[model samples]
Target: MLNASNPSADTGITPARRTTMLAVLMMIYTVNFVDRTILATLGQAIKLDLLITDAQLGLLQGLAFAAFYTTLGIPLARLSERVNRVSLIAICLAVWSGMTALCGAAQNFVQLFLCRIGVGIGEAGCSPPAHSLISDMYAPRKRATALAIYSFGIPLGTMVGAVSGGWLVEHFNWRVALVVVGLPGIALALVFRLLAREPVRGAMDAAATTVATEAPPSIRETIAHLFGNRAFLHITIGATLVGFVGYGTGTFAYAYFIRMFHMGYAELGLVYGLVGGLSAGLGTLLGGWMSDWAGKRRRSWYALLPAIGLLIAAPTYIVAFTRGEWITAMWWMLLPGLFHYAYIGPTLGVMHNLALPRMRATATALFFVVVNLVGLGIGPYATGALIDYAANRRFSASGLGDFATQCPGGVAAPGAADSLQSACTGAMAQGTQDGIVIMLLVFLWAALHYLIAARHMGWLKREAVASPAPARQPG
Candidate 1:
């Protein structure tokens, strides 16, 4: 547990060093997300080429990457506690980058899936160690803000992946885009290895003065400590639910635009990349800043802001998913993007506060396991499967049941895709819209958890003061 009074906050940190390190880490994280999520941007191309179902696409997006990532996350997180975190991150970055490039050359679904798994295996080392490093550099008060800044990588990566991926797919191909995006990370990893220095663990805490030689808790103990907190558990549930809805919806958002609004890939990339990415980035920063500011006044506000944000996002997303025109629909998405991402910085910040400093990596690793395993593992596939079901159902209901054999959506002839484009455009949009609209409702579910976490904040804080150690034992 944090000392709550961080006397070490004033030591070992210069503004210049802090800013540079955060920026570098953010760049690394950005690259990681780009590699992880670039697949979604290429959904149409991959789907058509592979001739696979949406569920299979979801499997590639969610399970293939997340299975290895969530599984290896804990042990690698355990390793981060004792090893040079910088080296671990660098090595992981290189491996994932290389594997991401390999995704370009995959000759079949199995090969691509395996390559995604390899990317996941390498990426497993990223967040926990990065979180540990960030916690060490920033004080408790500034932690959320710092972490939020670091998390900017998510939106940035999404931006690059969307725009560049769209361009690559349009001008060249998906394979070239993958290789192009990936090769840069290898060089960046080497640069990170050469330039970044590891901060002394827990240097931002009062306890840093005395525990220089203390060993971090065993992995079992670390997990026990983090999971022992009821508030932490509630927050984890909220975050997991958020990831579930976010990934599920986002994985298909590009395709939705293409199918719903008849947007070209170039337009889809630029519009979504700029509008969605920028809005999400702002929302992420705002969420972190809001939590930090409000938490200083009332700790519960950390979760409260996100809860409010999620509630606001639900309606916005519902509207976004329902509408057909790209112009009006994107306007609805701005607020949803902002509100949807608000939970990330604060939730992770709270988890860091919940555990002992030395266990920060382990704690974050555990958090990712629940969030990723449930969210990433299931969200996209669920949405994809629903799309398939709903599309088939809508096709059948439209009195085009006979044509279902030729076209899955019954909106096209087998060889004349553009021939019936105008007649059944609405039917084409129905399935994906329904799929997204259903998932958007899940924001309300996640919001409820955030609310519950806030309700327990006072009690949890008091308990933290009373005996942080007892919280380390599984209740």
Candidate 2:
């Protein structure tokens, strides 16, 4: 059995042990995502059962979850620095797993909303500690690849959520699907608690002949340290912008595909959930590998490649959105899918490299907090709101408003057409087009942050006050 408490003082772990830890972390990550994403895939079922609106779905998916998830990450990350990380992660997994099951049982909007907040709070405890732990387990040279491998949870979870949740919903119901998916996380938590062990802080420091035995930085100090790193600031903001579009697209793409392409639930599961997700996973790994290879030659390659990738992705995504044919759209989707993921690994790598070992988790938590609040919290809502706004315009033009003067839902415009459905569809189509174009432009703005990060990469490396010194080999 593995030690669940502290690591050995000789933090120079064997290769096999390091590999085992990475595997455990990846598994934990997979469970983390599975719980998070199932809700997004089953949105229609949830909406139908609860009689909720799109705006409410946005809150469920974004703000409610993000509110606590973002705020709690810093405190949890700080705690990990001072305590046993593996134990912290195990405890969080249990809490979130229970909350996930609770979501399935919610009978009303408030209950479901509160459950989502609980899920977020639990998830907030996961990444920062895992990041800090992996930083010590692998040398700086290997950290990006390790982290990328761990990050595979995002796509893997998405695939499972899409495919499994879709099939379950078709056969049974959303409540049952949530229960099935949520229950597995509890077993995973026990497994982690039994098998995982905490690693020594700053264990990868190879250059320093003498170890620094000082305590970890306080919360304010950790934050101040991150704020001082210019490249991290630019890259974090850039990543947030990318997330705004990336996450926004993920939440709405199914609805859009169903509307635009008439894709069945199973079809949505196969194409976007399976094909699209697998591609993103591959892209994430490849991006990390490329960063490792290219970063060795020029550090700016960390941010440069992603900027270039996003620039290429922008035009292709526009084409993907404009297509009337579903097959044509999916094909175009493949190209941008490859380009879209090129940033995640490198961006995360840059973040870890810029922070002290003790502060890596805190830095990442802060990064996640801002990124999720601005990006995940707002992205879906922005799209839904835009669509709603466009709906108003469509109704106004069709004179439906006049027709339903006393109706709370309002009416279609006068010249819109004979049938309300056709008028609504036309308006929605136009609005959807405008909304997507606006979201795509967000990528262009995000790309600039990557470019700015590219220029400042060297400065970030120099700003590291307590980064692990290059590791030493045995004589």
Q: Whose lDDT is greatest here?
A: 1
> Clash totals for all models, in order?
1, 11
Error of 2 at 441 (Å): 1.0
Which tens-of-lDDT digit does each residue in 324-388 have in candidate 2? Answer: 88888888877787778888888887677667776788888988988999887888778767655
TM-score of each: 0.93, 0.88
In candidate 1, the residue pairs with backbone N, CA or C atoms under 3 Å apart (3 or more residues apart, or in different chains) clash, namely 1-356
Number of clashing residue pairs, candidate 2:
11
Q: Where is model 1 more than 4 Å wrong at Cα?
A: 7-14, 402-405, 408-426, 459-475
- Please name the candidate that would achieve the greatest TM-score relative to the true structure: 1
lDDT of 2 at 410: 26
lDDT of 1 by residue, 1-475 (tens): 4576564454455768778878999999999999999999998788777766678889999999999999999999989988999999999999999999999998778999999999999999999999998988887777888899999999999999999999999999889999999999999999888878878777777767654577888878876777677667778899999999988988998989988887878778988899888899999998888887777767777777889999999998898777757898888877788988989888877887666778889888889999999899899999998887777777666564533454643345455656344434555567888998898899999999888877767622523231112233335
